[model samples]
Target: MRAPIKTTLLFSMLSLCMSCSNTTALNKGKEKLKARFEVAGICSNYTFSLIEGMADTSLVAASWTNPQSDSTYTNAFGVKNPCDLPEGLKVGDEFYFEIDSNRPNRCMVCMAYYPTPAKKLNIKVLEIVKE
Candidate 1:
């Protein structure tokens, strides 16, 4: 019984790994959008917002609260940074990025009732264009 369970677990893990790899491979050649970091969200789901029209297509979601967008937030528009931001990156960083639906796996961020961009996108920072 124990052996069978172990084998099943192993196979399940292997399957998960394979699926993840496939997702990464299939995400290639996606449209790259230019945006600037607006501000981190109140929680995991609404982690952050961008000032680019391309990614700011959150029709039903809460629009940005930054001066460049909503103008009610405390953040600003400056450098080039995208989602999945680097460790050293900060708000206002500008950069070209590709949306990664397979990344930043769904997670909670703040109060479910609190407002957040309806289409909170996952981003894979391709390159920082901050000068």
Candidate 2:
């Protein structure tokens, strides 16, 4: 009886560990992209020039080009701020980020046209690369 219970507990723990590892595997392979926050009219937007790709792009083996086109997208800014982004993010602030599908976006934001894609993409900011 006790042995069966222990076996069940061990199996459950193993399953949990496997799930955690799978999530880590995803984060491990993803490469962060850099972009600068640009202020526009009533709605702010992003500006990404052909300036270049990133990290290992310089290597001859990899195609050197910007990961995303110029201003591929923007964040969903609500009455306060983007759902996941931190406050005080201003124009010309550069940061590294990745698309985070798991991150929920329940914030309400306005729609507007911009230089780039002008679309909203939920992202996880890896770090502030520059400003």
Candidate 2 local lDDT, 2-117, one digit each (tens): 99999999999999999999989887546566656643334444432211234332221222222343333332221122546656556667777665656676676567744333
Position 53, candidate 2: lDDT: 32
Off by over 4 Å in 1: 1-29, 41-63, 66-83, 104-115
Write model 1 residue lDDT over 1-131, tens digit each, in one string.
Answer: 89999999999999999999987777553567666654554443222444454433332133445333455522222222232467665557777767656574444333543343434455677787758
CA shift of 8, model 2, Å:
16
TM-score per candidate: 0.46, 0.45
Candidate 1 lDDT score at position 53: 41
RMSD (Å) of each candidate, 1 decimal: 9.9, 7.9
| Clash totals, every prediction | 14, 0
* Highest TM-score model number: 1
- Span of ten consecutive residues with least summed lDDT in model 2: 57-66
